[model samples]
Target: MDYFATVLISSLSSASILLIATLGLAVVFGLMGVINLAHGEFIMMGAYSALTATQLGIPFILAIPVAVLVTMVFGALVEIIIIRRLYGRLFDTMLATWGLSLALYQGAVLIFGSVSPGIGMPQINFNVGDYTLAAYPIFMILVAAVMLAGIYALLTRTVYGMKARAAIQVPDMARAIGIDSARTNTLTFAIGCGLAGFAGAILLPIVPATPSMGFAFVIKAFLTVVIAGPVTLAGSALAAIGVGTGASVVASFMTSVAGDLFFFILTVVLLRLYPLGVSAKWRIKL
Candidate 1:
Protein backbone atom coordinates (compact mmCIF):
# COMPACT_ATOMS: atom_id res chain seq x y z
CA MET A 1 0.00 0.00 0.00
CA ASP A 2 2.86 2.36 0.77
CA TYR A 3 4.46 1.67 -2.59
CA PHE A 4 1.11 2.01 -4.36
CA ALA A 5 0.50 5.32 -2.62
CA THR A 6 3.92 6.55 -3.64
CA VAL A 7 3.24 5.70 -7.26
CA LEU A 8 -0.12 7.44 -7.14
CA ILE A 9 1.27 10.63 -5.66
CA SER A 10 4.19 10.73 -8.05
CA SER A 11 1.87 10.14 -10.99
CA LEU A 12 -0.33 13.06 -9.99
CA SER A 13 2.63 15.39 -9.75
CA SER A 14 4.05 14.29 -13.08
CA ALA A 15 0.65 14.58 -14.74
CA SER A 16 0.09 18.02 -13.32
CA ILE A 17 3.43 19.29 -14.59
CA LEU A 18 2.94 17.81 -18.05
CA LEU A 19 -0.63 19.12 -18.24
CA ILE A 20 0.44 22.69 -17.55
CA ALA A 21 3.33 22.53 -19.99
CA THR A 22 1.27 21.02 -22.79
CA LEU A 23 -1.80 23.24 -22.44
CA GLY A 24 -0.10 26.05 -24.37
CA LEU A 25 0.79 23.76 -27.23
CA ALA A 26 -2.85 22.92 -27.78
CA VAL A 27 -3.83 26.58 -28.03
CA VAL A 28 -0.86 27.70 -30.12
CA PHE A 29 -1.04 24.79 -32.51
CA GLY A 30 -4.79 25.18 -32.83
CA LEU A 31 -4.61 28.84 -33.79
CA MET A 32 -1.24 29.07 -35.54
CA GLY A 33 -1.23 25.70 -37.29
CA VAL A 34 2.54 25.83 -36.95
CA ILE A 35 4.04 23.21 -34.64
CA ASN A 36 6.71 25.63 -33.35
CA LEU A 37 9.14 22.88 -32.59
CA ALA A 38 11.06 25.32 -30.42
CA HIS A 39 8.18 25.28 -27.94
CA GLY A 40 10.55 23.46 -25.58
CA GLU A 41 12.94 26.38 -25.69
CA PHE A 42 10.33 28.43 -23.88
CA ILE A 43 10.39 25.85 -21.10
CA MET A 44 14.17 25.94 -21.05
CA MET A 45 14.08 29.71 -20.83
CA GLY A 46 11.69 29.60 -17.91
CA ALA A 47 13.82 27.13 -15.99
CA TYR A 48 16.97 29.11 -16.66
CA SER A 49 15.22 32.34 -15.77
CA ALA A 50 14.05 30.93 -12.47
CA LEU A 51 17.52 29.54 -11.83
CA THR A 52 19.05 32.92 -12.56
CA ALA A 53 16.64 34.61 -10.19
CA THR A 54 17.77 32.30 -7.40
CA GLN A 55 21.39 32.95 -8.25
CA LEU A 56 20.59 36.67 -7.89
CA GLY A 57 19.03 36.01 -4.43
CA ILE A 58 15.43 36.74 -5.37
CA PRO A 59 12.54 35.17 -3.46
CA PHE A 60 11.00 32.18 -5.18
CA ILE A 61 7.49 33.63 -5.27
CA LEU A 62 8.72 36.79 -6.93
CA ALA A 63 10.86 34.78 -9.32
CA ILE A 64 7.80 33.01 -10.72
CA PRO A 65 6.45 36.12 -12.42
CA VAL A 66 9.90 37.01 -13.67
CA ALA A 67 10.10 33.64 -15.39
CA VAL A 68 6.63 33.96 -16.91
CA LEU A 69 7.03 37.56 -18.09
CA VAL A 70 10.43 37.12 -19.69
CA THR A 71 9.33 33.98 -21.51
CA MET A 72 6.12 35.63 -22.74
CA VAL A 73 8.08 38.51 -24.19
CA PHE A 74 10.54 36.07 -25.69
CA GLY A 75 7.66 34.08 -27.13
CA ALA A 76 6.14 37.16 -28.76
CA LEU A 77 9.49 38.36 -30.06
CA VAL A 78 10.22 34.97 -31.54
CA GLU A 79 6.84 35.10 -33.20
CA ILE A 80 7.58 38.43 -34.87
CA ILE A 81 11.20 37.74 -35.75
CA ILE A 82 11.17 34.04 -36.61
CA ILE A 83 7.69 32.48 -36.60
CA ARG A 84 5.72 35.15 -38.46
CA ARG A 85 7.53 34.34 -41.69
CA LEU A 86 6.63 30.64 -41.47
CA TYR A 87 2.91 31.18 -41.71
CA GLY A 88 1.04 28.89 -44.13
CA ARG A 89 4.03 26.62 -44.55
CA LEU A 90 3.43 23.86 -42.02
CA PHE A 91 6.37 21.71 -43.04
CA ASP A 92 8.68 24.68 -43.32
CA THR A 93 7.68 25.89 -39.85
CA MET A 94 8.57 22.47 -38.49
CA LEU A 95 12.00 22.54 -40.04
CA ALA A 96 12.62 26.17 -39.20
CA THR A 97 11.52 25.76 -35.57
CA TRP A 98 13.78 22.71 -35.34
CA GLY A 99 16.75 24.85 -36.34
CA LEU A 100 15.62 27.61 -34.02
CA SER A 101 15.41 25.12 -31.13
CA LEU A 102 18.93 23.91 -31.75
CA ALA A 103 20.27 27.44 -31.80
CA LEU A 104 18.33 28.60 -28.74
CA TYR A 105 19.41 25.53 -26.78
CA GLN A 106 23.06 26.15 -27.63
CA GLY A 107 22.61 29.80 -26.77
CA ALA A 108 21.27 28.79 -23.37
CA VAL A 109 24.30 26.59 -22.86
CA LEU A 110 26.51 29.51 -23.71
CA ILE A 111 24.74 31.99 -21.46
CA PHE A 112 24.21 29.71 -18.45
CA GLY A 113 27.09 27.36 -19.04
CA SER A 114 26.76 23.71 -20.11
CA VAL A 115 26.26 22.48 -16.57
CA SER A 116 22.67 21.90 -15.38
CA PRO A 117 21.56 24.74 -13.09
CA GLY A 118 19.44 23.81 -10.10
CA ILE A 119 16.78 26.10 -8.69
CA GLY A 120 16.54 25.94 -4.91
CA MET A 121 13.15 25.00 -3.54
CA PRO A 122 11.46 27.21 -1.02
CA GLN A 123 11.51 26.04 2.63
CA ILE A 124 7.95 24.84 2.76
CA ASN A 125 7.27 21.26 1.83
CA PHE A 126 3.70 20.89 0.58
CA ASN A 127 2.88 17.45 1.80
CA VAL A 128 -0.04 15.18 2.49
CA GLY A 129 1.21 12.68 5.10
CA ASP A 130 4.13 10.61 3.77
CA TYR A 131 4.10 12.02 0.24
CA THR A 132 6.70 14.74 0.05
CA LEU A 133 5.13 17.61 -1.89
CA ALA A 134 6.80 21.00 -2.19
CA ALA A 135 4.94 24.27 -1.76
CA TYR A 136 6.41 25.82 -4.89
CA PRO A 137 5.21 22.94 -7.01
CA ILE A 138 1.78 23.25 -5.53
CA PHE A 139 1.96 26.86 -6.57
CA MET A 140 2.69 25.69 -10.06
CA ILE A 141 -0.33 23.39 -9.99
CA LEU A 142 -2.52 26.29 -8.89
CA VAL A 143 -1.17 28.40 -11.71
CA ALA A 144 -2.07 25.70 -14.18
CA ALA A 145 -5.55 25.51 -12.74
CA VAL A 146 -5.99 29.24 -12.99
CA MET A 147 -4.68 29.26 -16.52
CA LEU A 148 -7.00 26.44 -17.54
CA ALA A 149 -9.99 28.23 -16.10
CA GLY A 150 -9.01 31.54 -17.61
CA ILE A 151 -8.48 30.00 -21.01
CA TYR A 152 -11.82 28.19 -20.88
CA ALA A 153 -13.61 31.39 -19.95
CA LEU A 154 -11.81 33.32 -22.64
CA LEU A 155 -12.50 30.77 -25.36
CA THR A 156 -16.11 30.20 -24.39
CA ARG A 157 -17.26 33.54 -23.00
CA THR A 158 -15.18 36.41 -24.35
CA VAL A 159 -15.32 38.26 -27.67
CA TYR A 160 -11.59 37.90 -28.30
CA GLY A 161 -11.97 34.16 -27.99
CA MET A 162 -14.94 34.21 -30.33
CA LYS A 163 -12.84 36.07 -32.86
CA ALA A 164 -10.03 33.58 -32.31
CA ARG A 165 -12.45 30.74 -32.89
CA ALA A 166 -13.66 32.48 -36.01
CA ALA A 167 -10.16 32.86 -37.36
CA ILE A 168 -9.51 29.25 -36.54
CA GLN A 169 -12.61 27.84 -38.24
CA VAL A 170 -12.43 29.92 -41.35
CA PRO A 171 -9.30 31.98 -41.74
CA ASP A 172 -10.33 33.12 -45.18
CA MET A 173 -13.85 33.89 -44.04
CA ALA A 174 -12.61 35.65 -40.90
CA ARG A 175 -10.29 37.69 -43.09
CA ALA A 176 -13.03 38.17 -45.63
CA ILE A 177 -15.03 39.50 -42.69
CA GLY A 178 -12.05 41.73 -41.65
CA ILE A 179 -10.43 39.71 -38.86
CA ASP A 180 -6.63 40.00 -38.61
CA SER A 181 -5.41 36.44 -38.09
CA ALA A 182 -1.84 37.64 -37.92
CA ARG A 183 -2.54 39.57 -34.72
CA THR A 184 -4.49 36.76 -33.10
CA ASN A 185 -1.89 34.16 -33.94
CA THR A 186 0.81 36.24 -32.33
CA LEU A 187 -1.24 36.63 -29.16
CA THR A 188 -1.98 32.91 -29.02
CA PHE A 189 1.65 31.93 -29.49
CA ALA A 190 2.80 34.30 -26.77
CA ILE A 191 0.25 32.95 -24.33
CA GLY A 192 1.25 29.43 -25.18
CA CYS A 193 4.91 30.14 -24.59
CA GLY A 194 4.13 31.89 -21.30
CA LEU A 195 2.20 28.87 -20.10
CA ALA A 196 5.07 26.57 -21.00
CA GLY A 197 7.43 28.90 -19.20
CA PHE A 198 5.33 28.73 -16.06
CA ALA A 199 5.56 24.98 -16.19
CA GLY A 200 9.31 25.21 -16.56
CA ALA A 201 9.74 27.46 -13.54
CA ILE A 202 7.47 25.24 -11.51
CA LEU A 203 9.33 22.14 -12.63
CA LEU A 204 12.77 23.50 -11.83
CA PRO A 205 13.07 21.57 -8.61
CA ILE A 206 11.28 18.48 -9.85
CA VAL A 207 13.42 18.00 -12.97
CA PRO A 208 15.96 20.82 -12.64
CA ALA A 209 17.05 22.96 -15.62
CA THR A 210 19.26 21.79 -18.44
CA PRO A 211 19.64 23.17 -21.95
CA SER A 212 18.06 19.99 -23.30
CA MET A 213 15.21 19.72 -20.76
CA GLY A 214 12.81 21.47 -23.10
CA PHE A 215 13.24 18.82 -25.77
CA ALA A 216 11.93 16.11 -23.45
CA PHE A 217 8.91 18.26 -22.56
CA VAL A 218 8.22 19.36 -26.13
CA ILE A 219 8.26 15.79 -27.35
CA LYS A 220 5.74 14.79 -24.68
CA ALA A 221 3.52 17.83 -25.12
CA PHE A 222 3.50 17.66 -28.92
CA LEU A 223 2.78 13.97 -28.81
CA THR A 224 -0.13 14.65 -26.47
CA VAL A 225 -1.48 17.33 -28.78
CA VAL A 226 -1.14 15.09 -31.82
CA ILE A 227 -2.85 12.19 -30.12
CA ALA A 228 -5.62 14.31 -28.62
CA GLY A 229 -6.21 16.78 -31.47
CA PRO A 230 -4.73 20.17 -30.76
CA VAL A 231 -8.13 21.77 -31.38
CA THR A 232 -9.84 20.18 -28.37
CA LEU A 233 -8.64 21.49 -25.04
CA ALA A 234 -10.39 18.76 -23.08
CA GLY A 235 -8.90 16.10 -25.31
CA SER A 236 -5.45 17.56 -24.98
CA ALA A 237 -5.62 17.72 -21.19
CA LEU A 238 -6.92 14.19 -20.91
CA ALA A 239 -4.21 12.91 -23.20
CA ALA A 240 -1.58 14.67 -21.09
CA ILE A 241 -2.85 13.09 -17.91
CA GLY A 242 -3.06 9.72 -19.55
CA VAL A 243 0.40 9.95 -21.04
CA GLY A 244 1.94 11.27 -17.83
CA THR A 245 0.43 8.66 -15.58
CA GLY A 246 1.04 5.92 -18.09
CA ALA A 247 4.67 6.89 -18.48
CA SER A 248 5.16 6.91 -14.73
CA VAL A 249 3.73 3.43 -14.46
CA VAL A 250 5.91 2.22 -17.29
CA ALA A 251 9.02 3.83 -15.88
CA SER A 252 8.34 2.13 -12.56
CA PHE A 253 8.36 -1.13 -14.44
CA MET A 254 11.32 -0.51 -16.74
CA THR A 255 13.79 2.21 -17.77
CA SER A 256 12.76 5.88 -18.07
CA VAL A 257 13.79 6.38 -21.70
CA ALA A 258 12.21 3.08 -22.58
CA GLY A 259 9.06 4.26 -20.89
CA ASP A 260 9.04 7.31 -23.15
CA LEU A 261 9.51 5.19 -26.24
CA PHE A 262 6.81 2.84 -25.04
CA PHE A 263 4.39 5.69 -24.63
CA PHE A 264 5.38 7.16 -28.02
CA ILE A 265 4.70 3.91 -29.78
CA LEU A 266 1.50 3.45 -27.85
CA THR A 267 0.34 6.91 -28.84
CA VAL A 268 1.18 6.22 -32.47
CA VAL A 269 -0.80 3.01 -32.50
CA LEU A 270 -3.71 4.65 -30.73
CA LEU A 271 -3.64 7.63 -33.06
CA ARG A 272 -3.64 5.42 -36.13
CA LEU A 273 -6.62 3.60 -34.76
CA TYR A 274 -8.54 6.77 -34.01
CA PRO A 275 -7.05 9.05 -36.67
CA LEU A 276 -8.34 12.61 -37.14
CA GLY A 277 -6.31 13.31 -33.96
CA VAL A 278 -8.29 11.38 -31.30
CA SER A 279 -11.41 13.44 -31.95
CA ALA A 280 -13.32 10.73 -33.74
CA LYS A 281 -15.72 12.55 -36.09
CA TRP A 282 -15.11 15.90 -34.46
CA ARG A 283 -13.21 18.07 -36.92
CA ILE A 284 -11.07 21.15 -36.59
CA LYS A 285 -13.15 24.32 -36.27
CA LEU A 286 -11.43 25.48 -39.47
Candidate 2:
Protein backbone atom coordinates (compact mmCIF):
# COMPACT_ATOMS: atom_id res chain seq x y z
CA MET A 1 0.00 0.00 0.00
CA ASP A 2 2.78 2.43 0.92
CA TYR A 3 4.66 1.65 -2.29
CA PHE A 4 1.56 2.10 -4.34
CA ALA A 5 0.76 5.41 -2.72
CA THR A 6 4.30 6.59 -3.34
CA VAL A 7 4.19 5.69 -7.00
CA LEU A 8 0.81 7.35 -7.46
CA ILE A 9 1.90 10.62 -5.90
CA SER A 10 5.16 10.64 -7.84
CA SER A 11 3.36 9.95 -11.09
CA LEU A 12 0.86 12.73 -10.47
CA SER A 13 3.69 15.14 -9.81
CA SER A 14 5.34 14.24 -13.10
CA ALA A 15 2.06 14.81 -14.90
CA SER A 16 1.68 18.21 -13.30
CA ILE A 17 5.14 19.18 -14.45
CA LEU A 18 4.38 18.16 -18.00
CA LEU A 19 1.09 20.09 -17.93
CA ILE A 20 2.84 23.21 -16.72
CA ALA A 21 5.44 23.04 -19.49
CA THR A 22 2.95 22.34 -22.27
CA LEU A 23 0.23 24.91 -21.52
CA GLY A 24 1.83 27.74 -23.50
CA LEU A 25 2.42 25.66 -26.59
CA ALA A 26 -1.12 24.35 -26.48
CA VAL A 27 -2.49 27.90 -26.45
CA VAL A 28 -0.30 28.99 -29.35
CA PHE A 29 -0.84 25.97 -31.55
CA GLY A 30 -4.39 25.03 -30.73
CA LEU A 31 -6.12 28.39 -30.62
CA MET A 32 -3.99 30.58 -32.87
CA GLY A 33 -3.22 27.81 -35.38
CA VAL A 34 0.34 29.05 -35.41
CA ILE A 35 2.95 26.40 -34.89
CA ASN A 36 5.48 28.24 -32.78
CA LEU A 37 8.65 26.27 -33.18
CA ALA A 38 10.40 28.86 -31.01
CA HIS A 39 8.09 28.02 -28.12
CA GLY A 40 10.89 26.26 -26.25
CA GLU A 41 13.26 29.19 -26.54
CA PHE A 42 10.60 31.37 -24.97
CA ILE A 43 10.64 28.98 -22.02
CA MET A 44 14.42 29.11 -21.87
CA MET A 45 14.23 32.89 -21.89
CA GLY A 46 11.86 32.81 -18.95
CA ALA A 47 14.21 30.59 -16.96
CA TYR A 48 17.15 32.85 -17.59
CA SER A 49 15.12 35.94 -16.79
CA ALA A 50 14.11 34.49 -13.44
CA LEU A 51 17.62 33.31 -12.75
CA THR A 52 19.02 36.75 -13.47
CA ALA A 53 16.42 38.32 -11.23
CA THR A 54 17.29 36.05 -8.30
CA GLN A 55 20.97 36.72 -8.84
CA LEU A 56 20.26 40.43 -8.65
CA GLY A 57 18.77 39.96 -5.15
CA ILE A 58 15.12 39.62 -6.09
CA PRO A 59 13.22 37.08 -4.05
CA PHE A 60 12.61 33.86 -5.96
CA ILE A 61 8.85 34.18 -5.68
CA LEU A 62 8.85 37.71 -7.03
CA ALA A 63 11.18 36.72 -9.85
CA ILE A 64 8.41 34.70 -11.43
CA PRO A 65 6.32 37.70 -12.47
CA VAL A 66 9.45 39.43 -13.65
CA ALA A 67 10.16 36.57 -15.98
CA VAL A 68 6.59 36.55 -17.22
CA LEU A 69 6.62 40.26 -17.99
CA VAL A 70 9.90 40.02 -19.86
CA THR A 71 8.75 37.18 -22.00
CA MET A 72 5.34 38.71 -22.67
CA VAL A 73 6.85 41.92 -23.89
CA PHE A 74 9.29 40.06 -26.09
CA GLY A 75 6.53 37.84 -27.36
CA ALA A 76 4.38 40.81 -28.24
CA LEU A 77 7.27 42.28 -30.20
CA VAL A 78 7.82 39.04 -32.05
CA GLU A 79 4.15 38.78 -32.90
CA ILE A 80 4.13 42.29 -34.30
CA ILE A 81 7.34 41.92 -36.29
CA ILE A 82 7.40 38.29 -37.44
CA ILE A 83 4.31 36.33 -36.47
CA ARG A 84 1.95 38.94 -37.86
CA ARG A 85 3.18 38.34 -41.40
CA LEU A 86 3.26 34.58 -41.13
CA TYR A 87 -0.23 33.88 -39.83
CA GLY A 88 -2.15 31.16 -41.75
CA ARG A 89 1.04 30.21 -43.55
CA LEU A 90 1.86 26.93 -41.86
CA PHE A 91 5.23 25.95 -43.28
CA ASP A 92 6.43 29.52 -43.40
CA THR A 93 5.59 30.08 -39.76
CA MET A 94 7.36 26.89 -38.82
CA LEU A 95 10.47 27.77 -40.79
CA ALA A 96 10.58 31.32 -39.45
CA THR A 97 10.05 30.26 -35.87
CA TRP A 98 12.60 27.49 -36.32
CA GLY A 99 15.14 30.11 -37.37
CA LEU A 100 14.13 32.24 -34.42
CA SER A 101 14.67 29.29 -32.10
CA LEU A 102 18.19 28.78 -33.41
CA ALA A 103 18.97 32.44 -32.97
CA LEU A 104 17.65 32.45 -29.41
CA TYR A 105 19.58 29.28 -28.58
CA GLN A 106 22.82 30.69 -29.95
CA GLY A 107 22.23 33.96 -28.16
CA ALA A 108 21.76 32.15 -24.88
CA VAL A 109 24.91 30.17 -25.43
CA LEU A 110 26.84 33.35 -26.08
CA ILE A 111 25.42 35.25 -23.12
CA PHE A 112 25.36 32.54 -20.46
CA GLY A 113 28.05 30.26 -21.84
CA SER A 114 27.30 26.59 -22.52
CA VAL A 115 25.92 25.96 -19.03
CA SER A 116 24.55 27.98 -16.14
CA PRO A 117 24.03 27.39 -12.44
CA GLY A 118 20.81 25.87 -11.15
CA ILE A 119 18.66 27.15 -8.36
CA GLY A 120 18.55 24.78 -5.41
CA MET A 121 15.30 22.96 -4.75
CA PRO A 122 13.41 24.10 -1.72
CA GLN A 123 13.99 21.64 1.13
CA ILE A 124 10.42 20.70 1.86
CA ASN A 125 9.52 17.10 2.55
CA PHE A 126 6.75 15.03 4.05
CA ASN A 127 6.11 11.44 5.05
CA VAL A 128 3.84 9.45 2.74
CA GLY A 129 3.11 6.32 4.71
CA ASP A 130 6.53 4.68 5.12
CA TYR A 131 8.05 6.57 2.23
CA THR A 132 9.42 10.09 2.29
CA LEU A 133 8.21 12.47 -0.40
CA ALA A 134 9.19 15.98 -1.38
CA ALA A 135 6.44 18.45 -0.67
CA TYR A 136 7.51 20.54 -3.69
CA PRO A 137 6.45 17.89 -6.18
CA ILE A 138 3.09 17.59 -4.47
CA PHE A 139 2.88 21.36 -4.53
CA MET A 140 3.18 21.11 -8.31
CA ILE A 141 -0.08 19.19 -8.43
CA LEU A 142 -1.76 22.11 -6.72
CA VAL A 143 -0.01 24.55 -8.99
CA ALA A 144 -1.15 22.66 -12.04
CA ALA A 145 -4.71 22.59 -10.77
CA VAL A 146 -4.69 26.30 -10.03
CA MET A 147 -3.06 27.18 -13.34
CA LEU A 148 -5.57 25.10 -15.22
CA ALA A 149 -8.49 26.72 -13.43
CA GLY A 150 -7.07 30.19 -13.91
CA ILE A 151 -6.58 29.65 -17.63
CA TYR A 152 -10.06 28.23 -18.03
CA ALA A 153 -11.61 31.15 -16.22
CA LEU A 154 -9.56 33.64 -18.15
CA LEU A 155 -10.60 32.19 -21.47
CA THR A 156 -14.23 31.59 -20.60
CA ARG A 157 -15.30 34.56 -18.48
CA THR A 158 -13.34 37.49 -19.82
CA VAL A 159 -14.01 39.88 -22.71
CA TYR A 160 -10.43 39.43 -23.89
CA GLY A 161 -10.98 35.73 -24.03
CA MET A 162 -14.08 36.21 -26.13
CA LYS A 163 -12.17 38.41 -28.49
CA ALA A 164 -9.28 36.00 -28.71
CA ARG A 165 -11.52 33.10 -29.55
CA ALA A 166 -13.38 35.22 -32.05
CA ALA A 167 -10.20 36.36 -33.73
CA ILE A 168 -8.91 32.83 -34.02
CA GLN A 169 -12.10 31.14 -35.12
CA VAL A 170 -13.55 33.76 -37.45
CA PRO A 171 -11.29 36.72 -38.03
CA ASP A 172 -13.58 38.46 -40.52
CA MET A 173 -16.54 38.19 -38.21
CA ALA A 174 -14.45 39.36 -35.29
CA ARG A 175 -13.32 42.39 -37.26
CA ALA A 176 -16.85 43.13 -38.41
CA ILE A 177 -17.92 43.06 -34.79
CA GLY A 178 -15.53 45.97 -34.05
CA ILE A 179 -12.83 43.78 -32.51
CA ASP A 180 -9.21 44.51 -33.24
CA SER A 181 -8.18 41.05 -34.31
CA ALA A 182 -4.56 42.01 -34.89
CA ARG A 183 -4.09 43.50 -31.45
CA THR A 184 -6.00 40.67 -29.83
CA ASN A 185 -3.79 38.13 -31.55
CA THR A 186 -0.65 39.90 -30.39
CA LEU A 187 -1.87 39.95 -26.80
CA THR A 188 -2.95 36.34 -27.02
CA PHE A 189 0.47 35.34 -28.29
CA ALA A 190 2.09 37.37 -25.53
CA ILE A 191 -0.07 35.73 -22.92
CA GLY A 192 0.92 32.34 -24.25
CA CYS A 193 4.59 33.24 -23.97
CA GLY A 194 3.98 34.61 -20.51
CA LEU A 195 2.55 31.26 -19.51
CA ALA A 196 5.71 29.61 -20.81
CA GLY A 197 7.71 32.04 -18.69
CA PHE A 198 5.66 31.13 -15.66
CA ALA A 199 6.43 27.45 -16.24
CA GLY A 200 10.17 28.06 -16.45
CA ALA A 201 10.25 30.15 -13.31
CA ILE A 202 8.06 27.75 -11.36
CA LEU A 203 10.07 24.68 -12.42
CA LEU A 204 13.48 26.29 -11.94
CA PRO A 205 14.22 24.33 -8.79
CA ILE A 206 13.53 21.02 -10.53
CA VAL A 207 14.83 21.93 -14.00
CA PRO A 208 17.72 24.34 -14.16
CA ALA A 209 18.22 27.24 -16.53
CA THR A 210 20.57 26.31 -19.34
CA PRO A 211 21.17 27.24 -22.93
CA SER A 212 20.01 23.76 -23.92
CA MET A 213 17.29 23.31 -21.30
CA GLY A 214 14.55 24.21 -23.78
CA PHE A 215 15.53 21.32 -26.03
CA ALA A 216 14.87 18.90 -23.17
CA PHE A 217 11.28 20.12 -22.79
CA VAL A 218 10.18 21.38 -26.24
CA ILE A 219 9.65 18.01 -27.91
CA LYS A 220 7.52 16.61 -25.11
CA ALA A 221 5.56 19.84 -24.84
CA PHE A 222 4.86 19.85 -28.57
CA LEU A 223 3.72 16.24 -28.46
CA THR A 224 1.34 16.98 -25.61
CA VAL A 225 -0.20 19.90 -27.49
CA VAL A 226 -0.42 18.00 -30.79
CA ILE A 227 -2.17 15.16 -29.06
CA ALA A 228 -4.53 17.68 -27.45
CA GLY A 229 -6.07 18.78 -30.79
CA PRO A 230 -8.68 21.58 -30.97
CA VAL A 231 -9.70 21.71 -27.34
CA THR A 232 -6.31 23.07 -26.37
CA LEU A 233 -6.40 23.63 -22.61
CA ALA A 234 -8.55 20.81 -21.29
CA GLY A 235 -7.29 18.34 -23.86
CA SER A 236 -3.68 19.20 -23.02
CA ALA A 237 -4.36 18.64 -19.34
CA LEU A 238 -5.76 15.19 -20.08
CA ALA A 239 -2.95 14.21 -22.41
CA ALA A 240 -0.23 15.48 -20.10
CA ILE A 241 -1.60 13.65 -17.10
CA GLY A 242 -2.13 10.43 -19.01
CA VAL A 243 1.22 10.33 -20.74
CA GLY A 244 3.31 11.87 -17.97
CA THR A 245 1.87 9.66 -15.23
CA GLY A 246 2.14 6.52 -17.31
CA ALA A 247 5.76 7.23 -18.16
CA SER A 248 6.64 8.09 -14.58
CA VAL A 249 5.08 4.87 -13.35
CA VAL A 250 7.08 2.90 -15.86
CA ALA A 251 10.30 4.62 -14.82
CA SER A 252 9.70 3.74 -11.17
CA PHE A 253 9.71 0.02 -11.96
CA MET A 254 12.20 0.02 -14.80
CA THR A 255 14.68 2.54 -16.25
CA SER A 256 14.34 6.17 -17.33
CA VAL A 257 15.03 5.16 -20.93
CA ALA A 258 12.23 2.65 -20.70
CA GLY A 259 10.01 5.39 -19.41
CA ASP A 260 10.82 7.51 -22.47
CA LEU A 261 10.19 4.50 -24.66
CA PHE A 262 6.79 4.10 -23.04
CA PHE A 263 6.03 7.74 -23.64
CA PHE A 264 6.84 7.51 -27.36
CA ILE A 265 5.01 4.21 -27.82
CA LEU A 266 1.97 5.55 -26.05
CA THR A 267 2.03 8.68 -28.18
CA VAL A 268 2.21 6.64 -31.36
CA VAL A 269 -0.64 4.43 -30.32
CA LEU A 270 -2.78 7.37 -29.23
CA LEU A 271 -2.10 9.14 -32.50
CA ARG A 272 -2.95 6.09 -34.52
CA LEU A 273 -6.16 5.57 -32.62
CA TYR A 274 -7.27 9.20 -32.72
CA PRO A 275 -5.91 10.75 -35.85
CA LEU A 276 -7.83 13.96 -35.21
CA GLY A 277 -6.83 13.79 -31.52
CA VAL A 278 -8.66 12.41 -28.50
CA SER A 279 -10.74 15.52 -27.98
CA ALA A 280 -11.33 16.39 -31.62
CA LYS A 281 -14.95 15.39 -31.44
CA TRP A 282 -15.64 16.90 -28.04
CA ARG A 283 -18.50 19.40 -27.74
CA ILE A 284 -16.89 21.83 -25.34
CA LYS A 285 -16.29 25.57 -25.89
CA LEU A 286 -12.61 25.63 -24.96
Which candidate number maximizes lDDT? Answer: 2
Off by over 4 Å in 2: none
**TM-score of each candidate?**
0.88, 0.98
Q: Given candidate 1, what's the lDDT at residue 232?
A: 65
Q: What tens digits encode model 2's per-residue C-alpha lDDT throughout 1-286?
A: 9999999899999999999989988888877988898998999999999999999999999999999999999999999999999999999999999999999999999999988899898999999788999888789999999998998899899999999999989999999999999999999999999999999899998899998888888899988988888888989999999999999999999998999999999999999998888899999987
In candidate 2, what residue range of length 10 has the lowest lDDT sum?
24-33
lDDT of 1: 0.78
Stretches off by above 4 angstroms in model 1 are 123-143, 282-286
The per-residue C-alpha lDDT of model 1 at residue 45 equals 91
The TM-score, computed over Cα atoms with residue i paired to residue i, of candidate 2 is 0.98
Per-residue lDDT for 1-286 in model 1, tens only?
A: 6667666666666777888888878777754577889889888898888888878999766777899898899998888888888777899889988998999999998887778757656668745556665566556556666777877788778888888778767778888888897787677778788877877887787778889898778988888888777456777767777877788777876788877877888898878887867764665442
